[model samples]
Target: MPGHELRYDVNCSILFTELPLLERPAAARAAGFDAVEFWWPFAEAVPPASQVEAFLAALSDADVQLVGLNFFAGDMPGGDRGVVSWPTRSAEFRENVELVAMIGAATGCRSFNALYGNRIPDIHPGTQEETAVANLAFAASAVARIGGTVLVEAVSGPQPYPLRTATDAVAVLDQLLVERDIRNLAFLADLYHLTVNGDDVPKVLTEYADRIGHVQIADAPGRHQPGTGEIDLDGQLGQLERAGYRGWVGLEYLPSGPSAESFDWLPRHRRGGGADQTNEGDG
Candidate 1:
């Protein structure tokens, strides 16, 4: 089978944690990556202007593109998947949307990942779904000004996240399209999460390729670099490529050792896409 070369980017939020938040971009650049993605960087929904400036300046200094970003998911370190469905935090999520749009405008980053909040016990599932739909629509509309696409991802792990499968996430996207006619919403195909959740990986790539706005990968069993786990990351990515999905593939894995040394499985030359396509299958 013919192999398709995909563009790669580092998820600085996870890959370069050895350095301070503002310094990770340069670290990624030093490691031979031209593009990077990140989760919400600030503790609050809206950070101070100085902090925002510093964050942008770091990216500028390093000359790395911010290819992907997450909206304020509300205490991610504290195990909050997202607050899109949390009725009390609706206002906070909206504030984060504006900030996200501003960052997108400045960085030329058009892909935004919006994690659906976990289910609330006291809240009716219907009500939470309604809240999620409204918030997602609002986010999609805000980012649309910058020619952006809002991404909905199927997250794995122990959280009661409502969308645990590609079908589940797409159902929400379909709802958005039918109810609000929102065309800017798309699915974020995180291969590790989908696999961990027991969804048929090839089936999803075949069925939802056209709807995928972004792709993220980490080896399963443990979210580490590609070759360390049993997943055939290369083959699955090839399937995605053949299905006509041409988008950035984010390296969102934890390093088995030091962050810089974890990329041995992927050659430096193939880190950024261009005429150099050698050693494509080493991963």
Candidate 2:
């Protein structure tokens, strides 16, 4: 029985990388998903107008809903996971927020993720914390104009990102809500990263589901498709559903084989969310 309590969407940045960026949306549509999400679509915070136009046209062509997007994580493949917390990169992040807001509004995207910066040399922890909150506060305000919610995700990797646990991510979110008096800033509960960091997912879900704005999944030990590893993704998603989390659950995993082959666990009937691929070429 495929679950219908949640709407699952692929993270095009990770899942459909085999296709060109402009081609991923259609790939997702063909795979039966009517919605998709992504990391920032540009290498830089600001890019050429042509690039933005092509990206928008791609989604418009594919007819997939742009449900969620990240602001900008600096050089993700180069080992720079995020930069919003780094004081020196504050200006770039601020500029990116403006562009992120513009893109989110254009696509009718409802959620924006801001990954926390890793611990870099010469950047004091206290300073990074301050910068992260300030930038997020600004992002919350900017995106609120378009009815978008800002999210902070817990990350786990070789790098020392402060938000290595669900608690840590929620702490940042709570602080931002208090500091900015805004309700749009929320926690992004990623089941894979939380399990990777040795945090208990059920407890996190039990406690913070109401506060979470988004949910992402990839199995642990290897960030591959859900059933390829030990994490019980189906059970975890049930927790979210039981807790009343009706938002998108991002399939943010690296596929072990071809991206299309990765959805065997998800199944085609469950893939398009509640609808079939009837609107495939209408984008």
Positional deviation of 39 in candidate 1, in angstroms? Answer: 0.4
Q: Write the per-residue lDDT of candidate 2 for residues 184-256, one digit (tens) a residue.
A: 8778888899998999999998998778888889987799997789998878888777777777878999999
lDDT of 1 at 137: 96
Q: Candidate 1: deviation at residue 86, Å?
A: 1.0
Error of 2 at 73 (Å): 1.2
TM-score list, all predictions: 0.95, 0.94
lDDT by residue (tens digit), candidate 1, 116-194: 9999899999999999999999999999898889999999999899899999999999999999999998899999999
Task: Give me the candidate number with maximum lDDT.
Answer: 1
lDDT of each: 0.87, 0.84
Cα lDDT of candidate 1 equals: 0.87
Q: Stretches of candidate 1 above 4 Å error?
A: 1-4, 273-283
Q: How many residue pairs in model 2 have overlapping backbones? A: 3
Among all windows of 10 consecutive residues in model 1, the one with the lowest summed lDDT is 274-283
lDDT score for residue 194 of model 2:
93
- Candidate 1 local lDDT, residue 173: 93
